[model samples]
Target chain A: MKFLKIIFLISITFSLYAGEYAVVVNKKNKIDKISKKQLKNIFLKKRHFIDNQKIVAINVSANMPLRMKFEKSILQMSREKLNSFWTKQHFHGISPPLTQSSTNSVKLFVKNVDGAMGYLPKNLIDDSIKVIYEF
Target chain B: MSFKLKTILLVLSVSLIPYAVIMILMGSTLKKEYTENTLQEMQTQLQLNVDRIEQYLKTLNRDMHFMSRMDVMNDIYSKDLDKRISYLLMEKKKDLEIEGDFYLFDKNYKIIASSNKNILSDSKKINKFIDVEIISGFDNTKIGNLILDFSLKNFTKFFSNTKSRNYYIIVDKQKTLFLEKKFSNALKVQMPLKNKTNIEIVLQEDKEVFQNILKEYEAWFYTTLFVGALLISLIALYFSNRLIKPIISLSKAANIITNKKDYSYQVDVNSNDEIGKLSHSFNTMITSMSNVLDELKAESENKIKLLQEQSKNEMLEELSSNLSKYLSPQLYASIFSGEQSATLSSKRKKLTVFFSDIVDFTDTTDTMESEDLSELLNDYLNDMTQVALKHGATVDKYIGDSIMLFFGDPESKGVKEDAISCVIMALEMQEHMNILHKRWINKGFTKPFKVRMGIHTGYCTVGNFGSENRMEYTIIGSTVNLASRIESSAIPGEIFISEETQILIRDSFETKEELKITPKGFKRDISLFSVKNENKKTNKIILNEKGLSIVYEPDLQDATTKKDLKKTLEEFITKLSV
Candidate 1:
């Protein structure tokens, strides 16, 4: 039982560690690293358009706690508390985001796409990626 | 099928109808109360939340109006019209420190200036993002318009004051502000319920409420159910024991009385209700029934006792009355016990006995009124006894109208002329009986009575006979029986006697020669003669029967009851004449 508890704790810790997230843009994008205030506004969908282009956001798998942690960290709130906000948006026809899994996949997709933003851990950052904000 | 089960079923049916009605009313009231309370609470909460959101909207409107009146945008519009838009945008960003981004648009809806330094916009950034409602604020015939984007980073901090509450703001331009993380993989966007509508315009804030609501819903369900069950139990207990109890008791008592035939039941009803009244009435009815039954029982007992007493009296009367027909040896003692004490002793002495029969009565009564004939016979016997009592002799029982009387039975004197007096009584009885006999003739009854008598003197027993249980008040000896045989042998209306009687009265009466009769109970043929008159005057008579010679007294032949001898002589004379 103790071993099982240890395994459970380890998995939770790994999940927590895995969700260390930063907002990234394309490597060739002209806008430099933004402040946390601007990043929060973009990620929370306060601004759907930036730099004359529609700002599209990406998401990750729900059961992956890493993805949940990324959402909580970057959005700076609990998932349940966040859903209540979006549920209100459903009447106004404002959806949250198009989502994907794995930091590498999000990075590759963001590189090819314009005005795309998403979160990945710093460990997943590579030379082809541009870090826009961190939480 | 049976009475008791049917009775119980009837009670259950009546009880259930009202119980069902009460239960339905209880359930409906409970449902209505709970629903009204919950819906009112939810509606109040929703209104409060709506007021909170509208307050923020008013604030935004006020802030926007304040910015519209600012001198900074006016300074830019007064400068070179094309050059002033950029300067107005830069200055407006400084003045509106509450909003992070700023933009300026001319009448054509084109972005005129940029605040951020980058290749940030493929086109103009801010003007395209503003809603028509905001644009109209600047559009009402003004020089130009300014739009500002408020900072969303501090949104979570703004909502922290609410209790377990989260919120998001979205502009009409599709700028979304969320203060919480969101679930992405719900196949459908099923917002928690509020008045059957999704909690729109604040998606993330509404999702946080559903978990608590689900718990609250479950708790309210269980709690209300528990309370409802308890209330129903209390209701059932109260009415079943209180209201139904007395009625049930009354019903049971009634059933017990009806089935067991026990009217000894009572009910105690303390309630001042209908059931109590019913109990009181039931008790009254039972009391009445008990009284009636008691009276019936008493009357029945009285009738039985009275009948018993009447039968007892009848039996006593029958016991003492004599049978006038024949000597039924049975049932004679009860009558003989009532006789006077002077009638009996063990030592036998001389006594005179008489016997008689209805002459040819056996042939005469072939068809007759049985009751009339019996009444006629009783009357005749009554007159004969009255005459015998007058003559100081006891009238024995009769065979038909054939009566046997005796003197000195019960009371006899020494050598007194008792046989001659018995002859005179017999003559008077025949004379008196003509009155009753004429009545019999009018009633179409034809029967006649004639008597024959015999007398003798001998030593005999004169008392009751047989035993203490059964006896006859009679004289019995060989001489007495000989007198009875002589009477049987005589013609109707004649008297016969033994030689013994003639010797007893030989000095005072006239006698004829006696004929010997070897009849029943005689050792040899004894000489028997007849007696006629009360005073013996003549003595020149003798009996000659088949060459046996004996003396007879002339006083043995009666003047009236001796008509049979005259008839026989007349028949003889007639035979000679014919």
Candidate 2:
């Protein structure tokens, strides 16, 4: 009966995180947590390194539903505004981010590379990667 | 082929050919219909199976979709949560009659939970995935993929209760997932399931059913044909026997007649049909031939008998003509003409009986040679007999050189005519004897025959006067004897007749002066006369036994007569002196 109450409390708390996404990184990374602004700056290639290591930020493929969700909840920018920003950054000899076709590939990239970070549905988090931020 | 066998074959073929054709046509048509109907039936059955399998696949996809939306996927952060998901999938698998495993993959590309509870093998990882959908929360946050290792048995099991002659197949895009069995030839129908499942259900029918039907039809067709032909043959043979029996018998009967040459044999008529009528006609012809043969035989026998009789009659005529030579013509005519019969009998009638003998024929015969005498005698008698026959005298018999004959008994005129014909016949015979004498002298006969004949008219018995076997047609009694006496008493070369004959012949003949003599058969002297010519001039001179008497007219004696009388007186006186 107490276990049932504990499950009920967990369900209540998870409602607060509804429509939110978690930014994950490999467990080997030294950063235990990260601010959404810094993560967005890293995904936009404004900061290329973190904790004296090179940072590799992963994005899902263009038009992927998860990628659209991640862009809306984390990047906080319209598609047209991001398209101009990436185009400006592409001229400055900086690529925006590396993209994967599915959330599974984004998770695999984060788990295998150090200092790498990606986002997925919050219910899809597993032990192979750490959530550095949530959106 | 013999006639009967050919006829039988003809009948069998005539009846059976059409029957076999019809049977074959019907059998083939029925087999075609059966094949079409069976194919249609199998197609409908395969469609029903395809529909059921499609529906079953749809139901499995629905189950899989419902299971994917369960609340356990949102507990990915909890410990032992993967084990809980696997247990829940196992429960669904039992309820849904599913035959394969289920797997739940997290967003990190790891199988977080699976119903198989084993490490992912390579072969198992290549399993057919059905209803691969995202597991999501109420916030539409993307979870991992829910994968069902879809079982084709659930699809193929729909046809498990079907016949052995059918198969069911399940196929996806790349490979055939499940099939009941392999099939080379089949009638296949495919049905794709509704949306989420990428599988097709196929139904197929084996070809052995149609092949079996064709074999059965062929066997039935040949069997029916054989039986029908046999029946027709037997029936034809029976009828041919019925038809040919009479003809065979007729030929046999004809052969018998030809070989034996007997037309009396008849064929049996057993029916009133045309063959029977033919037998009747044949029998009738035989009977007619037999009748004609019998008639011909009888006619030929009669002809032979007539021929024999005719030949026998010719022989009898030849014998009778020969015997008639020894008989008198009157007697021969009378007997042969059936007027007289030869018997020992006599009848009295007025007959002119004549008898004649040669004058001193014995003395003449003794002087002449026997051959000459016989020749002279035959000539004299043949001539006399001919003369007598001309005068219608019945010549009776010849006594040496004498002839005894009679007229007026077998045939005659009145008594006076009879006497005259007898005397005339005697005169003619004398003339004929003179001719014979002249012929004999020329033949160097020294002495010739002299015949004298006498005639008498009296009532004498003149008939066949001998035994029945040896008969002589002659005249008998005193009249015959007197005729003989008169013939003997007459002078040589003179014709003498009795007074009865003289009285009858007096008018036709002249008589000498009547003298009186007594014959041995008479009791008194009978007057006899020497017949002479009546037309001579009369100089009556009579010489009696003692004296001479003369009465002559002196005018009648001429000078030659006076001289002859003087010379005769001198010679007479001189002979008287001697």
Candidate 3:
């Protein structure tokens, strides 16, 4: 058991230096390098139109690590806070972003849809999607 | 009931029966419609809520799956990733709009991160695993469990349209999950949740909605029925009055006519209906009755007048019969035969008048009993009146025991014959006095009652000579006075005649004595003569012997009567000699 404890501690210490995530948009998008607050606004549906183009925000599943990192780093909100915020937005006829099951699907949605934005690990990022921000 | 009331009730009932039945049917139908519509509306609302809940659940599942696949899940093995996991959980809670905590646990069930920080210290076991999702690493290896405790509050807000109502999601008889508000009593509607096992949503409905709808419909039903009944009753009353008023008035008029028995009264019939015609017929009956009564009254009056005339005729006949004894036969006959009128007018005519009376009647009455005296006087007067009527003299009147008679007035032979008749009547009356005297002697009256009479013939006023009320058919003139004067001067048992009467009867009668009678009303003395009839019975021989006197009528020229008389005389003389 002591050995197992030493192993668990080493594994936890190694996970602390995990790699960063990236926020990507469609390759055809005109603007890049969006602010963290603007990304948060996009996900919350507060700023649907930017640069005269309708934006479509996408999200990963609730239990996904990349989505958790994106919520903490870019949106800077917890799961409970987003739930409450979207519920309030629903009263004003607004909706949260669309969701995907995997990082590859998120990348594919961003590649296919105009003004689409999503987050994924840096390794999963491809030429089809343009990385707007990294958090 | 009165006619108007009956009529109104009849009409009202006729309309009200069908209307009430239709209203009842309509009310029931409306209530059925309300119930059906309410059920359909509740069903639609329940379905919408069910759709919303399913959609929310789907979103939660999709989001949890997406989060599990993120590259940030690699940080799960790192000791410094607890804050990051906690923040991610909190974000998920906010995004899902839940009032519940979220938890990230390691493979060993040890809590790693949670949205509610206080949940880490509590050793209490979880009430349930509402949504337990797997959290995976970047290599698709299982990392931990992601749990979400969903609050029913937001779903309750979605279905909060019903207040004072309750909803429960009952998993068993005892375990119930309240969706909106907690309630003890409820109507249960079972709803199945999508992609769920052995779980159902129970929708509860309050009875208040149905009750309110029924109350509104009831109000409308009663109001419409009441207004319809009132309007129909008013119309019935109006029409009934129009139909019944004339009949009532006609009945009143009929009552008046019967009670008063006045046929002149007329019924006021304004309309030309059957009642008006009846009134006209009644008026005709009264008129006919009144006319018949008038005719009966006139006929009765005529009968009464005729009876009165017949009775008056009977009375006059009786009076005239009694008066005929006072008038002379000829005068009575002439007046009754319409030959003479009873006007008080006198005419100058030659008449032979006669007067007669009892001589010393006062003296005889003083000596005799009154009854015997009246008897003897009636006997003498009866015989003298017989002799006067036998000579055709009109006996005018009798003043006590005296008589005045005239001839040649109502009926006459001639002036000369009238004088002769008057003289003969006077002479016969005097001769009748002798017979009456003998009759009185046999009646035990010693004194003889003698009568004196006189006759005259001259121009005299005769006929009805008195006033209109007491006119008498009598002679009144110098001739009448002269006859009265002659009667006064004559001796008892004698008749005197004036010169005119004596000359008229000189060839028929013998004069016994002559005298001058100057009456008080006469201007000159009237020569009167005591008269006897030439056919008087003076041939009788009277012989007195002893105390007896005998009277004999001898027929000497007849041999048979002379022989018989001689034989009787011889027997009487021989008896006297012996």
Tell me, by TM-score, which candidate is best.
2
Q: Count clashing pairs, candidate 1.
A: 60
Q: Write the per-residue lDDT of candidate 3 for residues B1-578, one digit (tens) a residue.
A: 87767887888788888888999899899888876776676667677877888898788878877776664543344321335667787787877678777776666767767778676654245433354556443224576766766565545655644674544565544456666565454445666666653455666666555576578779888999999888877877777777776677667766876898665666665667786777667667767776787788798898898889878878887888887877787888889998779898778998888888888878767887888777776776677778878878788878888988887877777777677667756766767777877887788887776778877788998768778798777777777877788888888777888887777766555775576756887778778787765643457553323234444555333888788878987998899899
What ranges in model 2 sit over 4 Å off? A1-135, B1-251, B269-285, B342-349, B383-393, B408-427, B462-465, B472-475, B491-495, B498-518, B524-578
Q: Reference contacts recovered by each candidate, as fractions? A: 0.00, 0.00, 0.00
- What is the per-residue lDDT of model 3 for residues A24-118, given as tens digits with 9 covering 90 to 100? 88899987768778888888777877787777777877898778888888778989998998899889876566666667667765775566778
Where model 3 places Cα greater than 4 Å from the true spot, the runs are A1-135, B1-344, B348-354, B358-366, B369-371, B374-395, B407-459, B463-474, B479-578
Q: Score the docking of each candidate (DockQ).
A: 0.01, 0.02, 0.02
Query: How are the candidates ranked when ordered by lDDT, highest leading?
Result: 2, 3, 1
Error of 1 at A117 (Å): 53
Q: What would the C-alpha RMSD of candidate 3 be, to one decimal place?
A: 19.5
Candidate 2, B1-578: lDDT as tens digits: 76767766777677767877887798878878877887677678767776776677667677777777765553332312325677877788777777888777666656767777783744445465574565543335566777778666655566654453655455555567556566676656556655534466565666565566568877887787788767776787788787788888889899999999988999999999998999999999999999999999999999999899888888888888887767777777788887777777788899898999988888878887798778777877788888988888887888888888888867667676777778777887777777887887888875666666677889998778767777788878898888888888887777887788888766556776445678886998766666663313445332211133233344567999988977986998798799
CAPRI band for model 2: incorrect
Mark the 10 consecutive residues where model 2 chain B has the least summed lDDT: B542-551
Flag the better candidate by TM-score, 2 or 3.
2
RMSD for each model, in Å, please? 28.0, 18.3, 19.5
Worst 10-residue lDDT window, candidate 2 chain A: A10-19
**All candidates' TM-scores?**
0.36, 0.50, 0.39
Q: Kindly provide the TM-score of model 3 when superposed on the true structure, using C-alpha atoms.
A: 0.39
* Candidate number with the higher lDDT (2 or 3): 2
